[model samples]
Target: MKGDLSTLVFTGCETSGCEMSRSRQYDIKRFCFQTWYYDATEGRCSQFWFGGCGGNENKFATQEMCETICVEPPGRGRCYLPRVDGPLRCDQLQPRYYYDYTKKHCVAFWWRGCLGNANNFNSFEECSVFCKDVGPFDEPTTTTVPPPAPQNIQQFAPTPEAQQIDIVSAEQPQQQPQ
Candidate 1:
């Protein structure tokens, strides 16, 4: 793309007088946040790739913000209700896989805390028991074949032909020793 002057944030030549007069000079502050929401349909915290410009009120500035909105409410029913595992960490939970009701398969999600519910499972195998039946997790395999070697191509050459005989001496004169 061609360089656009209108999109330039700083020209490095702005006078102090211009800076003082302008209310907002080169507002190039870019803000990016990982926004998450409790996907009741998926039974996990679904994330969105937000380009921080204009957004809706449901949008949050942090993962905590999303949790406050979607998780804190009583009977929010956003998360999974897995079997009660003792001392489930409500805080400092790690990301793990859970079964998505809508997708009918296992998916990755950041667990917020240890809460006893079938929607929550320690692993995909655990979740699969209560949810839809999914096949065992298998690593993807790849096979590569090397390219063929270059061959020496043979070229054709011209063959020699018979030479023509000169007949001028036979008709003129048989001058032997002049």
Candidate 2:
């Protein structure tokens, strides 16, 4: 039996008269089939070829796809939100536009054929399409409020005729003939 252990080390298993150990007794269906097994060491699902003999208990037939059973992906466990490497460029052969607050309108500008910020748009149409709808510059409305009415306020209109009357009244000052 001691010699059998040595042979098992090289051959992985004894071809004859070797019952599966108690740990591997669960693999009752060890047959020639490609099955998926969770490779805990690599944290992924791996293809395992089951021999028509005794084997380990890690065999799984479609019960463990890599995504569902393996470890979490690069970031979150399930959902993957890609990183924003950089801002969207403007020199993409297609004309682009940007909204200028000073101008109060979408203005056309040529990108320097280099990397640019996301403040730019791919086209004038694209810029105008969303500039009005999604920002502080939507369609404008005008409403006029009349000025307040006069409140006991005296406003004098000194015309030339009023000045002449005042001069005559000054010259013919009140004279009592008594």
Candidate 3:
């Protein structure tokens, strides 16, 4: 599979694996890891949980890899286009970011999850990076918020101090009488 993938990548062939659905193989051990996959229909890379076995080549180690392999490089004019929320028929509402040519910065918006133009990006950083050179502004005017973490990935637990504060707050001393 590795050899075939290398060949396909080097030859610039359309890899059928990009069209495969995210596969979380069922295993007794159940070793799951966060991974990225190319969503051919949406024309973007998205995060998915991989069971660490029996998945297709669509699984990429990083979003950049998936985009490099599956997505076409954006054309010169793509950055100047207005934000598109995609068609109304698709109900999946995904939080996405796009470069606002007028605003001259990246802004977050809800994408309808299909057929949006290349202006749409998975994160503010991505949109900014791609459109920075193309836009009228020399640099983004607004402060950037870090992109949301992947849904399937586990977030860090609260700090020990925070937990202690919560415990103390929960155990308010009982007052005897007024």
Candidate 4:
């Protein structure tokens, strides 16, 4: 994370309530997509944060990018459009949840589309371009409901000694070199 780069395509707002750039990294075809950075803050995706699609706002890659080619897209799926235009403008889609380590938060977003290429390339930067093209939309399956955390709902209840545990657990535990 020392040299981790923050991306912005247009004004470069450094926004985009997203992370998992390093976690959801995947292969869409010949390219590699890596979620290298997660947004520690949110308001709007910077120019690079909100990538542009070949089509309207309906089409967007995941907020998290894998590479330049590979990306999460709004594929042909049965999506339920909400009465009110929800956060993801696509329609009514189920939200997917991921534990973000960099942000130390459980992030949520709707799956809107598929990876552009489908082939996994080498560098994590390869698939990042896909993120540049896709923006937030009506994820065919998604919602923005972060699982509830422990708060003092009872006024009389005694406060616990600890606040909460860090939810960001690395998939592969790091091993120390001998």
Candidate 5:
């Protein structure tokens, strides 16, 4: 209802809608739904609960829609970039994984969920695969250790005679009629 049809088409990466903060109606009659929004500061899409009434153009039905509308595709050397925890204004602790160029491996970090960099990943495996070629020159070796054998609990069990004695003691004799 505001911009022309050209505004609907994504011609460039920059979108003011992406930069807008998420909003939700605070009224008692508010109806909330989960939605995705492009976090321009973090350069990624994130989920947020939206109140059905008042929201901005930043809201999207899915992560894909948000990305297609606002996020720029990953470029070369993305893995080499430093990890970002995003802005402190949002203060949502999200556990994330990122490739550590110095360590030559993926490590865990707490993402503030608003404005981090593309180096952030949802899992260690995701980070490893994405930046596999960017790390150490030599492939890291891993040693697999078999799990310990199950203990023999039979030794702790009571013998048949002991069990029988306990059962007999536990039984009460029939009471005579008064």
Candidate 6:
């Protein structure tokens, strides 16, 4: 663990002038993979990556593959979701590849890209709903994360190579809003 703990920290959401508050464990809001907001900086995606999977093993749910269709294609968002159902959601989202909220994980494939994420959300169901309503993925920031000193897993920052989320930005014929 060599980087700033604040980098991975997430703040709650403020919407419609309503301040939404949640305990560290359960907060209803959205978070981008990058610590700094890119859309705020510019559409330029400056995310750096060594590797990431959003726990989704299926090919169709890949945000990168689906970018061609989704209006706001999910970028590296899947990696953080942790709970998915089917093939990665790609250019043309197949229903079978759709996320199943009840499974607490993806259904047909190694991942569903559906169930709410444990890494980011409160419950498996919450993670699923969040992913289904909002795109589930994140872009890796370029900052280097030195290898863990091996003292504490809780203190360890994920390897920089392990930070990149696999996803794309594009519109598809069948993809729905994230």
Best by lDDT: 3
lDDT of 1 by residue, 42-159 (tens): 3334466555665434444466544443433222132222222223223333445544434545555545445422345566665555444333433214221112211221222333
List residue ranges in candidate 3 displaced over 4 A. Answer: 1-74, 138-178
Which residue ranges in model 6 land beyond 4 Å of their true spot? 1-76, 79-119, 133-178
Q: Tens digit of lDDT per residue, candidate 3, span 75-115?
A: 53455444556544555567888776667778877776677
- How far out, in Å, is residue 54 in model 4? 24
lDDT of each: 0.37, 0.37, 0.61, 0.26, 0.58, 0.26
Most accurate candidate by TM-score = 3
Q: Distance from true position, residue 132, model 6, in Å?
A: 2.6
In the predicted model 2, the residue pairs found to clash are none
Look at candidate 2 and tell me the lDDT of residue 99.
55
How many backbone clashes does every candidate have? 11, 0, 0, 53, 1, 45
Tens digit per residue, CA lDDT, model 4, 44-110? 2222222221212211244443222112213210011111112223322333443222332224433
**TM-score for every candidate vs. truth?**
0.25, 0.24, 0.38, 0.18, 0.37, 0.15
Which pairs clash in the backbone of model 3? none
Better of 1 and 2 by TM-score: 1
* Candidate 3 to truth, TM: 0.38
How far does residue 58 in candidate 1 sit from its true spot (Å)?
A: 18
Q: lDDT of model 6 at residue 161?
A: 89
Per-residue lDDT value at 90 in model 4: 30
| TM-score between model 1 and native | 0.25
Task: Please list the residue runs of candidate 2 whose C-alpha ends up more than 4 Å from where it truly belongs after superposition.
Answer: 1-94, 134-178
